[model samples]
Target: DTFTEDQICQVQEIHVGKPRIVATIVPKGSPFKKMMIYG
Candidate 1:
């Protein structure tokens, strides 16, 4: 999945004074996963 430029910009603005938003996609039984942090 991809985020539009506007969506990304909006998220960036919201992240300015707070901790970044972290997203993870894990399988049903996966213990390890990758995360994407945005600010």
Candidate 2:
């Protein structure tokens, strides 16, 4: 995966009502500045 273990953990913590949605985490200027999650 593009995300690290900690980054993955951060994504897992997020909760939403929709089954399919996009998630963007981390700050700008970093390698993983933008992340897209869809499942």
Candidate 3:
């Protein structure tokens, strides 16, 4: 099955409604590693 860009975006809009907390992951040698925090 194949989905167009519009179709994929629509699905994401429904599922990714709200984000409580966001975390940025970086490489081990990078400045910031896997750091998680509350919302």
TM-score of each: 0.29, 0.26, 0.28
What is candidate 1's lDDT per residue for 1-39, written digit by digit as tens?
999998877774343585787766767655454332221
Runs of candidate 1 with Cα error greater than 4 angstroms are 13-39
Q: lDDT: which is higher, 1 or 3?
A: 3
* Error in Å for residue 19 of model 3: 19
Best by lDDT: 2
Alpha-carbon deviation at 29 in model 2, angstroms: 56
- lDDT tens per residue, model 2, 1-39: 497987877774566566887666667676565333222
lDDT for position 15 in model 1:
36
Clashing pairs in 1: none
lDDT of 2 at 15: 61
Q: For model 3, how does the per-residue alpha-carbon lDDT over 1-39 read when each residue is reduced to its tens digit?
A: 999998887774365566678657666665444232222
Q: Which is superior by lDDT, 1 or 2? A: 2
Given candidate 2, what's the lDDT at residue 29? 70
